[model samples]
Target: MSESANDTAQPVTDWEGYSFDTRQVHAGEYPDRNTGLRVPPIAMSAGYVFDDFDDQVDRFAGRSIDPIYSRQGNPTNAVAEERLASLEGGTGSVAVSSGQAAISSALFALAQHGDHIVSTASIYGGTRILFGRSFKRFGIEFDYVWDADDDAEWERAIRPTTKAIFTETIPNPRNDVTDLRRIAEIAARYNLPVVVDNTVGTPALIRPFEHGADIVVHSTTKFLTGHGAAVGGAVVDGGRFDWAAAERAGRAYPLITAAPRPGLGSMLDRFGTGAYARAVREAVVNDIGPSLSPFNGFLLHQGMETLSLRMERHVDSSLSIAAWLEQQPEVESVDYAGLPSNALHGLALRDYDGRTGSVFGVAVRGGIDGARAFVNGLRVFSRMTGIGDTRSMVIHPLSSTHATFPQEINDRLGITPGLLRLSIGLEAVDDLKRDLRAGLDRVAALATPAVSLAG
Candidate 1:
């Protein structure tokens, strides 16, 4: 007998039409029939046993979607993948080893050698590096549009070989929110699918699909995992992109829309709305072998249970702290869109309800000296190179994440000597404020004159 057939209480598999809070807790959770385990247990097996010879053949022949190897899929990871897909309103999702892997797999399925991709210039520093170095080495070209609003710039960048348009929902170190609707419109004109990295802006704050994105990627290591414990990533298929339409328009995605063998059908034909995600799993992730560990997969599902509750605290604290930082005398500027004075505040109000996100940039009065002093003075905020953590963290972007970039690129990105990226955590608001004040005090002291040695 099947696990569900024998169990008295069946798991809630379909999370559609449920509230975000309800789905996050209950969606994708399967009851353990053998032991009646309340929570989904870690599926540690590398392979599953088949009942007979035909069962194994059917799986290999694409007649069934059963897992043949842990490298492609895992039950523990499936819970997290399904929960995330439901949360993001996608048809399906694929979990991977890291955010970079998710991005690489998502794009590799769409564009291969000789193909090109257009991206919004403002994105994660690591992503930019990946595109410039590894993707370039693979013969996959990338063109960047500095201004998303400028149709001319976008037109100039997008070419006949362009397979997709890439961007971020809430780009960090500078919380400048992208206008997904506008980009989607541009993409529709060219029949290109829009791939968005909703890493900084988790589904709690913004569902990119709702705003017209065709695909969504996440660095589950950050906000989705909630804690700093596990490092994982996921790619969600919005299920709305018309694959046939894009192919007709001359941008072919063979991995998703083409068949693998003489007798087999295409992923699009077999899976319909879920084709892209299946292609990412079978074609890219399986071949490259960036499978997420079941151990981290367990942590991912558990972390998502309290996503909304954690995000509320994260955004609430960020709004308060951004406002406070803007008023500090030693602070040069704040890059949080939640601040009314910010250039992107209008966009933030329109889409994000003024709660942009926790990670943002703050420039102190002094140059690198002020940044060094401020970083050294912070007792509460950690001096680190990560964002979206439960603990408040600070890092000088110009000297760290953006260090390898050319001076011109850093200048364009506004990564100045004194600019520091702050990832606010679930810590007390007052304590976080005090920590900022201490950092500012250090910056203020940089300008203070000392007594003459002669005296």
Candidate 2:
């Protein structure tokens, strides 16, 4: 026998103790047994084979977690899920078709038709639309707390039927960072789990779980994918919430705590720390059928590999651009928390080290006309509705994202006519500044009065 026969070596599989940078690239990847493929290949099969009759029975009966169908789970999606979970410091995650699917699945797992959710006033406008339109039609109500710091406002918003507290780590457009710790404290008092949207503030910058969120959701289409080539989403379970205690306190999450069938145990008892994610996967995502494609799943995992690196460049460019815009005569104000002059700079410094993500707002001198001129003037920045992409993007939220909402609601949320949301990208900082100056020049032209030559 060869000397090597006496020793056996196994690949490093457990990534729990690895640093974020290392884990991002290696956490969910596994050696392909058949061909020793280093990269995780997209397993596109819709159905999985069972070992025997008993294996199929076990799978359908919930005895085995092996995927029976791709609608429920897939190997490719699993890689993205595990990688996202590892990065977000969660017990488990479920990849879905889109960010809206992730949010709906995540909340649907906890609340039923009659339940309510309290969210901070300043959130993604699309999310607000989802709540007002789809969620409202489903009989699930939402209340917005404008002043998160005011306990009275939270008290007024959160009712007895409230099942979850929803908030974003960094609210879109304005870049107003939520006080997650305060929200967590309020959630703890009511025995409600806090669900945070970390799409804007990716795990590379701020893991909401560390700040006390119980569930984290992401729009993988944005920063996590980096290239903006794929649209996907994921819901990660923080695994620290006390479900039993919450039930005792009169907040019951039936799907997680109740058995699907008489013979089967509750997801909480079966999956333990990963129960919430399991509930989201099996109960909501499986039932709703917003499954992520294997191709997108492959892209999501690959995109995460460079998440931290991209976020660093994104934040650096944003900081430089935001500071520059503040001094521009045509600019009205910059809504970046990283700026010392901003109201949320203290919170940004404490939680995010003053490196808030690249997406923020810049208001020009004139109102709607100024926004129109500024947007039409930009050459480098793509005028689009998406954020967190590798290419810089700009959108007039008042005209696009928040157009359907009432004027008072827009005013309350600070979606001003002159304000333009900017997503700084990986381009050279000087180039981005020059592009922005071009936009500001248009805004300045708007303020200039036309000469009356006839006079």
Candidate 3:
């Protein structure tokens, strides 16, 4: 006789032990107990129903981890948080309204008013602005290490007040990949946590924790969502950094390790290994009020199912496209580490299996005017200011994204007039190539004609 569906309880799946593709699908999903639904249903309600006054007390008092309010936590958002935590090999995760919030909240969770953060100079323009402008106004300081590979430079930048070391795994536009292992080594010596923005190098490409990152942040608006539909961000806690030890060693991360109330002890004392994430979700995110909607959470979760596949296609198309662009007569350079000609190709091969992600920079021969002709003439590649979408998109950083920066700062960061950032999509590689050729042809078409001296 055949076994019945409920005859025996199957062993629980070891999601962490599974491959990336597998974990992306099944990591945080659980069948509905009441309805036996295969997919986890989105809990749209703002607040969960309480059984009694005592039950409410337990939840509101932080004695229970269950959702009390949507802003703090939602059933749907919880699933996303769990899935992201699993994908990043983190112990916990906190979802926020946007990528910027993820960075702000994650950093604020560690660094306070008088604290400092050392970051790579080549980070996203918005992040740089937030650190230099908004965060600076709030009394938090940020220092940058321009040459990220220089281990001594990283060490020299650290001061007694430096609380954390930060950088993007693969800095946007410019493709100089940071040496995570080396930075982590320095952070370890100082008892400081290394926080990495893995937005571009999604877990599909690189898991920062494997290289010693203690916290991982993402703009779920990018590859995590796959489609250009949802906007969200996540902060994943690797649960390895000893915040208590850091505090004891003179690095003051009191935001998560100190008590704000007389009756309440430190998060580290109460939650142990889960303290960082606990503080992020309960204190920082709740206070900041940048909450991810349940709808976006559902959409983001849907996107993760295809992250592995979309990322693979993106890498393949991007590699071919970058190589082709390098040979173009109207092109100056292609800043894709995937190309063997790139200075960072060896790092790409060792780190990301020779794929540095679909986002890269292409400099056209005719400066700003040439770039305008190329982008405006293209049909297939959308002239949009976004990355990690299912449709190829392009943007000029100097005139748009990084236009506010000082000229010297722009030059240092490689946000040149002719440099165009490309976010290659799932479209046919040949189609993308042909569209790019048309753009280049337009640049040539608009060039000044040679003087007819022979005539």
Candidate 4:
């Protein structure tokens, strides 16, 4: 789709000052190509018909023209991108193969061989692995600031080569609410872009851009997709950060210096509003080839139509279950900020209006054996690694998702042996409670006999 028509088709109300709920339903809906139908269709074509040779040359020369290939852009992907951009209050978006790919592309777009990234230690297990190991091979150094809550920690972690400050809105398993505004301030001081993973606290729950985040990324495969069917990710450029300003401040980002383009100027100079996003699309997404399938994009779009409704149920049911679990003796602690007793409750209340996401971790009194028994005993909640599915899911982070992290790192990140992470679904609350009770009962039974031995 050409930017000329699509950009002027419908002013994105959310991005263009529309309310959140209204934007969710009508953000990037293009009238049908053939029949002028309201819903945008999945364009499965691999290439587009150019008007002329000059237009083809213009397309290749970074002119604002329609897409040329499926790998670079598709109508289906464009709809998703528009919707995401609208929802995240961004200038534009790029859908990628996976969340890790989104993170990788976004980082590589701004940082290079000699550049560095300052990140919150509390983040997804896969993200941790990607930054700690994968990016290292490319000579891109990533340092973690353990105390993300401490502004001083983030300030100290920034190096002259640091190009971005990365953190999750609500870190998986940890469930700690990041102070986006504070982090944004810290990033502004250094003239670095703030990249936030808002997968958990989807836009329905929290909009990071409003708090000064320069860019937002999501594992659309999670809550945004609403179901566990697709594997995709999206990056949204808030269009707020002045990349040109960063460059003016002596920040030499890779896409500005290394990418091959003679008259195109630096990414910072060309795409004033979408410099980072355009860089990722042109350089990493085009060269590295992390494109989302059109079919997956269709599924993700369908999922988005009902996202707000699903999130409401997920949050309500999760809060109910988390509260019940807090009263259980078997549960040593519940790591849900919605619970008044949680250490992060105050922060969550302040930032998220007391909505602490559906995904949370519960610490059992007993250790690994107890955790395994509880997960296996659950009837309704599927024992899987993924979260934000329509159906409830349970997993032992220590033994599964966070297993890659060394024990010391895992512990430091608040993933302990007794903790079980749950992705609450839209199932009947009573039914979910019954299913959870069965698992907790089993843990209690096993723990009762084991306590005698300790005595």
Most accurate candidate by TM-score: 2
| Model 3 Cα lDDT, one tens digit per residue, 407-448 | 999988888889999999999999999999999998887676
Please, what are the lDDT tens digits per residue for candidate 4 over residues 1-455?
55786567663334367777767777777767588766677788988988999989988888763677777888888888998888888888999998888888888888878789999888888888888788998999988988766767876788888989999998888687788888888888889989999999999999999999988899999999988999999999998887666878988765754445677666666677877778778878988989999999988887888888999999999889999988988888888888888787888899988897998889887788779778888989998888999999988988887887787888787788889989999899999989988888889888574546554
lDDT of 2 at 3: 53
TM-score of each candidate structure, all chains considered together: 0.97, 0.98, 0.95, 0.93
**What is candidate 2's CA lDDT for residue 434?**
98
**Ranking of all candidate structures by their lDDT, best first:** 2, 1, 3, 4
- The regions of model 1 sitting more than 4 angstroms off are 1-10, 453-455
How would you order the candidates by TM-score, starting with the best? 2, 1, 3, 4
- C-alpha local distance difference test of each model: 0.93, 0.94, 0.89, 0.85
Supply every candidate's count of residue pairs whose N, Cα or C atoms clash at under 3 angstroms.
0, 0, 0, 1
Q: Name the 10 consecutive residues with the lowest summed lDDT in model 1.
A: 1-10
Model 4 misses residue 341 by how many Å?
Answer: 1.1
Q: CA RMSD for every model? A: 2.4, 1.2, 2.1, 4.6
Model 2, 119-170: lDDT tens digits are 9999999999999999999999999999988999988888889999999999
In candidate 3, where is summed lDDT lowest over 10 consecutive residues?
8-17
- The RMSD (Cα, Å) of candidate 4 is 4.6
Please provide, for model 1 over 254-278, each residue's C-alpha lDDT reduced to its tens digit, 9 standing for 90 to 100: 9998999989999999999999999
Alpha carbon deviation, residue 39, candidate 4 (Å): 2.5
lDDT of 1 at 277: 95
Top-lDDT structure, candidate number:
2
53 Cα displacement, candidate 3 (Å): 2.0
